[model samples]
Target: MTRGKWVAGAVLSAAILVALVVAGVRIWDVHQMTSDWALWPKEVPSKVQFANRDYQCGANPMPNTHSLDGLTKQGKTAGGADIYSAAPGTQSGTATWIVIKTGQATYTCDLMGGP
Candidate 1:
């Protein structure tokens, strides 16, 4: 092959390689974003990078009873359910909240104006 032909082939190969790399990165990013898109009750926290935006857990209050049954305070994700917490007994204004999760989905309670 002539010198000119060899240079042209090298440039073309380099361009194709770059294009493939860029395309691969884009495809991987899209897949990651959409994989968690279908999660229930979408409320991702600020620290999470998988989401496009940060969200504060709304105040979803529990029912009349403060059921602390069979749950540890400051529990781990291993609970496989919503974690519950509340202020001391019978206090007029105590923050009662639940950190609920199912599968990979997790979110804080959106209690109605109760801190």
Candidate 2:
């Protein structure tokens, strides 16, 4: 084989290897993100009423309950649930609970224990 042909083959092989590695990394990342959460027995409600306003949990962009209406991130539970305070200056009595599983986030007005 010509020297030029050999070099081209080597470059093509390297490119393929790099592409495979990148794809594998992305897949691993997705799996990690999804599997990191602990399982919750009950499904997250589609909508939660807080401060007399309904917030959708399953929407494309999850509500930023952590920073919305004076709600702040209290902390993460052992089961990987993110806890947020209710909106300030409102009669919302309970803290918000957020759990992520299978790459989707669900929210509730009650505190759900962590994994």
Candidate 3:
């Protein structure tokens, strides 16, 4: 191959390698986070953030209002649990949630923000 063509090929290969490395690292980090969620502290938290959408509860059933994942501000539920939206100006994201109870007063936020 010509010298100029060889140089171009080398540069392109390097760029692709770098991009792959970045993507792999991100996927690994997410996997680690998801695995660690099983050990999530069972405490009433003011705010919750979980990378995995599914919250594991063998026999425990999540509340109906808490199951929906979306934006909410001053949102009220039939169970009388007050909720607030995480980001006010963003559109709703598609994800499911299962409320896992911690203690007497802690809120178990599943899959991110709520409706």
Candidate 4:
């Protein structure tokens, strides 16, 4: 192969490698953020009723209202708890009332507003 062509191929390969590394790092971050809540038992109910309102696990969307990964990234931490909005940002009345107990391997949801 021509020297110039070989150099071009090397540059393209390096670019692809950089892209893959960036993608992998992002995926790893997301995985680490959600791993705590994602492994909760499916048979166990994560729902909680507080103030006559129903609040479910915020990790998964199918059975919950918000993504845990999104919550962890965007939520605020206070008094050993991670507080997040009950609903997604697009929705109105998204109260930052959902609290998750932190500093443990697994998190427990406390809709009652306690850490």
Highest-TM-score candidate = 4
- What's each prediction's TM-score? 0.33, 0.37, 0.37, 0.39
**TM-score pick, better of 1 and 2:** 2
Query: How good is model 1 by TM-score?
Result: 0.33
Q: Better model by TM-score, 1 or 3? A: 3
| C-alpha lDDT (0 to 100) for residue 35 of candidate 1 | 27
In model 4, the number of clashes is 0
Q: Which scores better on lDDT, 1 or 4?
A: 4
Candidate 2's TM-score reads: 0.37
* Residue 89 Cα positional deviation in candidate 2, in Å, after optimal superposition: 17
- Give the local distance difference test score of model 2: 0.44
Which has the better TM-score: candidate 2, or candidate 4?
4
Write the residue-wise lDDT of candidate 2 on 66-104 in tens digits: 333445654443334554554455544544443323224
RMSD of each: 12.2, 11.1, 13.4, 13.1
Regions more than 4 Å wrong, model 4: 36-59, 62-115
Q: Point out where model 3 deviates above 4 Å.
A: 35-63, 66-115
Q: What is the C-alpha local distance difference test score of each model? A: 0.43, 0.44, 0.43, 0.46
Q: How far off is residue 48 in model 4, in Å?
A: 15
Query: Which residue pairs does candidate 1 place in steric collision?
Result: 58-110, 59-110, 59-111, 60-110, 60-111, 61-111, 95-115
